[model samples]
Each structure stands twice: as structure tokens, then as C-alpha cells.
Target: MKNPCIRVLATGGTIAGKAGSATRHDYRPGQIGIDDLLSEAESLGMAVTLSGVQIANIGSEDIGPAVWSPLHAATVAAVADPAVDGVIITHGTDTVEETALLLDLTLPTAKPVVMVGAMRPADAVGSDGLRNLANAVRVASDPGAAGRGVLVVMGDRVFAARDVRKVRTRGTDAFRGFPRESIGLVTPSALDWFGAPWRMGEAARFVWPDQWPEVPVLPIWAGIEPDYVTRLTGPDTRGVVVAGVGEGNMPEPVRQVLRELAVRGVAVVRASRIDEGLVDREPEDDANGFLAARALNPPKARILLQLMLASGVSVRAAMQAEFDRR
Candidate 1:
């Protein structure tokens, strides 16, 4: 390998997807090991440096701080090493976006962090994992992609980590949201675009707050119980994120609990459940409880909340300011 140290973090996802029977779409995830995946790299004609970390194999719903903590810690550590230039994470599609978003905000380094996944599991007859892996190799090895923060490479298209989202239900290109941010794209006849690289050669740049606060993102669905909110806002809670309805609307019951949380000194931010659009403030409904004027997604808003507390930024003002900085 020419580059010798492009770390490959194998937190299993569909790319490593395997099935109970080859004919079934249902997969046994976390089945493939890192070495097997790496074995394909050599065949792909890649000259990139490589390393692997097995952070988790269960469904991302099963993924939480236990898995995220070590996964994040490993990524932070990898970028600090002079021997390592970039990282490639193979994760399941379900939570890849969330993990990618989390790392986008949490990781302390700027080294390129590219995440990729497959719609079809490794066991599928025409599984897209290998090609996805190959494309990631191309992107990670590209000397131009440093300092761009984390990224997602799949279907031969590159997307910024923060902006990537999945729109398709069952296609190799199921994971959408990347090409929109593409300053350029590598097409079949135009494979030469692959050579352009995604960033400048300098390393990465990631600046985090000196302190990090613990915040919880609790969701509220119609006709749901109230215990969920109270438990999340109980003692030791620093912040609460209600995955409110459209435009930050919430069930009257849930909204009341959220207000109580705010009254108790816990920061409460309102974000919509819808994937698109800013969480609108329902003035007639009394939704001044949100921090969305700062223009943050629920998860990112929660992260900023932690960063705010860590930095001693006033909660209310921090909620508004997070949007300003973003």
C-alpha cells in the first residue's frame, strides 16, 4: 500500500450484511469481520493505508453511548497519530447518519472521516458492499480530502457527513443526500473525476468545547404516556430535546411536561420530527420553549446544548446562539 495507514473503522452495518438464507432480504448484520472486508481492498487495486476497529454489530437501535463512546474515542485517537491519514467506517444504514452526525460534532480531529453502507447485505448475490468499500478507499486515499470533517462515500458519489441522508428504500443508491453538495461527481465515462480528491492535503480541523454536558433527546408521539418525559428530566438531567411535531408543535400533555422541565432549570429545545425544514415556532400554541431559532436539527441542537453547558454559555441564550454560530 502506498499510504500505509488509512484506518478502517468497521462498525457493522448493511455493508457487512449477511442473510439467514441467501434468498431472504433479512440479514444477520455484524456478521463480517474487518479482515475479510480488508481482504477485498487489495483486490480493488487500492494503495491506501488501512486499519480496523470493531465497535459494534448489533442494529444501531442497539447502539448507544456504550458503543458510541469507544467508537468515538477510537476515531479521536486515530486522527492524532501521525501514521494515520484518514478513516473509513463501515456502518449499518439505520443509524449511520446519526453516528456520522454525532461524530461530525463530537470528534476532536479534522482528519477525513468517511462512512459508507450498503442497501444489500454482504450475502446478497449482487451486494454493493465491495464497491462501496472500494469507493471509500478511493476517497480516503485521496490526499485532497483531509480536513473536510467526516464524510459518506457510496454509489460512487461523495457527500458531506453533515448533509448526507437516505431517501431510497431498497436500491444500491438508497442512501441519498450527498451529490447535492458535490462540487463534482465521478461518473462511469467520467471516472477521471475520482482523481480530483475531496479536500486539500492539509490535515483536518476539529475544535470542540473544553467541556461537554450530558443531554437527552426524548421523542413524543401522539397519545403517548407522560412518564417518558419526566424520567428524562429527572435529577441529573442537563437538557431535554422533545422530538416535537410539525413546526415544533407538541401534544398538549407532552408540551406541559417540557415546560416543567424548563422551569426546573433543564434546557428544553423544540425540534420537529419531520426530516426537512426548520422547526417552526407555533406562536398561537406557546412553543417559545424551543432553541430552533438557532437553526439546528434535534441531534445537533442537543450537542450544542452540551457544548453550551460545557462552555458555561447561558442555556436560553445558548439555545439562540447555537443557531447563530451554526
Candidate 2:
């Protein structure tokens, strides 16, 4: 039997970072290349043929539409290839979850799409990049990983993109699934899944946009000035996501500004500032013409709203429907 062919799509993150010294925490991310990283993985001697494809070499914080467009295109092409069995994206931990969500919403889920990253720089003491890379390859090559949407493998846990979040600033255990536990676990010898099989795919995907839309997340807080809300309205602002306090609530002043924006055809979504909870529609939300972001954090909500605006479909209805999903 042939070895499973996995394309290691590299979007540089800490996994590729190089520190001043093994003991030093300060380092520059994206300093190493995909070929170099793959060489480390190849040393493990897994039954897999790894092809390194360099997509971008930037810290995850710099990830935006410029990188997303090409990443999506390359991923789609790799997935469509007859010889490729699965794909792995090595990304930065800071914003890997957002990128994972974006790919999960746009790509076909028939094959495994795994996002892997390291909390520590590749050259640091106790560096975890190789372990994560090996684990990601294991998951990608696994037949069971198919149709489960994009998976983020870190700390030996496999998280579905929709629920994964970067919870800690530094550590081996930086990522977690919110409101839901990890769907599975991975080890050197075995893979185990705990949840019922659920899939996300092109059947429920948004059309990849030619132009990325401008959707900004505005944070709401105690004594938030009205200018903060009012300034968000402009010709280029296609949508606005408010990281509202507690169940997506804001002061009446902020609500009024949002209401006006909603009336002007800008998509307005209220997502929670809290980490792990649903933002359901309050009674006033309907009257104000606002959509609740449900379990989506502010950043993910912004991504979804941008897609909705870019497609120019039934924006209001689509936003509401997706937010309502379990």
C-alpha cells in the first residue's frame, strides 16, 4: 500500500519561530521555512509522504485577506488533487482559531484539514513544534478525520475549528474548545474520539469572496462613549460586530447607534465579550434589527459577517440562521 500523501501547507507561526537561545522566550516568528520543519517531521519516520508548500511566512497576527485568499486557493487545489490524502496547515497560535474557522466555512470537508501550531518557538527549550507537527500528520492521515471539518491539533487534543480558542498566553496547553470539549485525542500509537460524528463542509460553506469585505469588531464596555459606536458608521463599513457586555447587552446610547446603522443596511451583530457563552437575541434585538452572534466570539463573528457581506446574498437572514445553529 502507498503511504498517505499529506501536503504540509505552511503559514508560519511559532512552530517556525527561532529564538535567540533555547532558554530565551523572545524570538522572531516565521523565521524557519516549511522544508526545514518538514525535515524534522520526516525524522519521525511516520508512514506518510510529506510535501512542503510555503503559503506565507508571517506571524498569525498579520494574517488577513491577503494571506487568506491564497491559502484558500492552495488548500482547495490540494484537496482537489487525486494523489493528496489530507492537508496540514502550520499556523501561529495567536490567531489560528480564526483562520481555522475561515477555512472550515469555505472548504469541502471530505478530506481532513488540520491546523497545527506551537506555543513555544521551534528552537526554544521544551519546543513542541515537532510533536504537534507529528500529531497533525497522524490526524490528517487518519481515515476517521474526514468529514469532521477543519481540526486544530495542540496539546494532544483535537479541536474542531468552530469551537477552538487560544485560552492561555504561553504554555504547551494554549488552545481549548469552548462550550464543548475536544472532539478527539491523539497519541503516538492511537487516536480516540469522544463526540458523535458531526461534519462541516461545502454543503454549508460560504462562497469564497473575490474581495474581502470590511467588518470591524467594536468592543462594548462600562461607560463606553457614544462616539465609539457612532464612529463605526462610514461608507466602507459593511458590517459591525459589537463585543457587548454580558449576553450581548450595551447601553441604550450604543444600542441607538447600532439601530441606526442597521436601518442603513449595515449588518449589525451582537457577540459576547465573555469567552464561553451564547449571545442570544434579547427582546430589544429584534426591534433594533440586530442579530445575535450565539456562541461566536467577537473575532469569529467578524469573519462570518464579512463573508455574509461579501456574498451579497440574504445577509440578514443568513447571519441570523448561522448564529442560530447548534
Top TM-score hit: 2
Model 2 ranges with Cα > 4 A deviation: 200-204
Tell me how many clashing residue pairs each candidate has: 11, 0
The Cα local distance difference test for each model comes to 0.68, 0.88
Query: Against the true structure, what is each candidate's TM-score?
Result: 0.80, 0.97
Q: What are the per-residue Cα lDDT tens digits for candidate 1 across 112-199? A: 6778888888878788888878877776765556655577776878766655667667788765552244433442223223334334
lDDT (C-alpha) at residue 198 in model 2 = 76
Cα error of candidate 1 at position 249, Å: 1.4
lDDT of 2: 0.88
Model 2 per-residue lDDT tens digits across residues 72-173: 999998999999999999999999999999998888887899999999998888999999888999999997898888999999999998899988998899
Q: In model 2, what lDDT does residue 80 have?
A: 92
> Which residue pairs collide, candidate 2?
none
Taking all chains together, the TM-score of candidate 1 against the true structure is 0.80
